[model samples]
Target: MTMQSLGDVVGNLVDGIGNERYWRGGKIAEPGVYAGVDIERYHHDPDLFDGFSISSSGLRALLRRPAEYWWSSPYNPSSQEPESKPALDFGKAAHMLLLGEDGFAGQYSLRPATYTDSKGDEKPWNGNATSCKDWLAQQAKAGRTVITETDIAHIRHMADALSRKEAIRLGILNGKIERSIFHKDRDIWLKSRPDVIPISSGDFVDLKTAASVDDETLSRAIFAHGYHVQAGLLRVIVREILGPDAFTSFTFVFVEKAPPYDVRVMQLKDADIDIGERQARQGLKLLRECLRRQEWPGYDGFDQHISYIEMPSWAKTRIDNELNAEAA
Candidate 1:
């Protein structure tokens, strides 16, 4: 068991994520079995790489395309703008914030571009080495217990499964009558908007980050805000792309960064879920509309029209009625 200081591990791999190029001045030229399409070939014909061919087309070419295109290109920033709101950007999330995930129903979904340069040294979602070191220094000054991955792993002598207990409870205590997970199959016409379709379990599992958390505080807050809407949108998109087998539940695992690195699992209920679904549907519609209008939603700037809608009354009413019926 290797228990080095938290300062040692992590923040080293994705330490400088915001950079346009690899963190290291030189390419992360590690000779390993990296699974991905050849970038050189992608340059000529992105389709050969997969569905991302159109999405990955050169910059100048995309600029000539129309505004209604849902896919993004080098110069044509069709996706959310950098100045956009605090919504999760998978690339930025993985590189800037460790909050983004992929791989399985709810594992880590890393893009090929990112995985190509990765070395497993740093974690970006939590910020890079600079932010992490600064936070660590602050923690050290306060005399709090520092539990780095190495320390935790050594103490428990277990490999990465941090949420083992909860997983067992979900799988064993609860009869997962059905469960499903999937990745978004990227294409030129469409983007990678993948999500898991839990046949049951009553919710769509969402992931998020927090500076710190206990247990109880996690449940109430996300009711107001979190990435649940994103999950809901993913649900709707998955249903649209795959078929109608969307998830029935919405779970959020808000991982804290403070001492203890505690994780809070909150099962979104009636109102919480209602809001997400409402927004999910709305956002999807809005995104397409925006694409058609060639007007991307701006996060940094305000939208006077959007502010008029207060969580949607119809959705809330339906949610309340459902809760009342369930209780009855």
Candidate 2:
């Protein structure tokens, strides 16, 4: 008998969910390759890896606070209350409309107007609103997609605007969407799900709902969110899993959550990705070291050291300009 590959071992474990082979009908399946399953399965499964999945978001967390990462990561075998995030819900709805297989029908239902308030606002009637809300919750609990009619409209507006962009439309003409890929190196399991992976071009695209897509605003947002890290790491992982022919470049399609629903397809050039790769490398090295030591420290001797807060560059630049003006 030959030893199974790590990917096969993981896949078998996940496949045993709700069966006698593993947890004996456990509600949540283990982490592994699940073909012909809802994409949500990959997103909600907490038991996907014995150690840490080291996601791009998790990389950011590791960079921020190692102790928090250690305590909250799957390796700790601890749990936390699943709090509802309205922003995340809204983003999921947008993702459903933009990338999911069923488009709108798979995620939402309609309700009729039921009651008129004293302020003259008519709410959905016949308990329809409540019913829809309950259904949405149920769908989410089942690891299925769900959304609102208002969210649908918002998505349509963004789609229409995006369609107007000839280059982007051409780039996204035919590609895979919402496919989760994982790479395990030693104890570290790196995972990424590109929103869209272009087939022939080998370029991936991620959809994001943001407040603004302006040059400066989006640039700052990208930096603040560590999206570059995500982009760089995802490219490397996809290549590692699927091979060098699988990933070449990355792009982010940013859509405004409100109003005219402006859409911007921002492509990170080699230069930007180079910086991201450096950051990712640093985070990965730190993560590996912390995991090996099993001691997640906070702020590297922060208790003993006295640190000074420095003025931000933008503020310092403004101050310098004002001082120079005064001298003139």
**Model 1 quality (TM-score):** 0.38
lDDT of each: 0.37, 0.65
lDDT of 1 by residue, 131-215 (tens): 5556656654653323334333332322122345475346422221112222232212322222222323334454455544655
lDDT of 2 by residue, 35-148 (tens): 333444444455655655677877877777777566566556664424657677778777766664553555444433355555666766433455545655677675454445
Q: Provide the TM-score for each candidate, comma-separated.
A: 0.38, 0.69
Clashing pairs in 2: 31-48, 113-125, 114-124, 114-125
**Top candidate (lDDT):** 2
- Give the TM-score (vs. native) of candidate 2: 0.69
Which stretches of model 1 miss by more than 4 angstroms? 1-164, 168-203, 214-226, 241-246, 297-328
Task: Give the C-alpha lDDT of model 1.
Answer: 0.37
Candidate 2 segments exceeding 4 Å error: 1-41, 44-46, 68-72, 81-83, 102-148, 171-173, 298-328
Alpha carbon lDDT of residue 272, candidate 2? 80
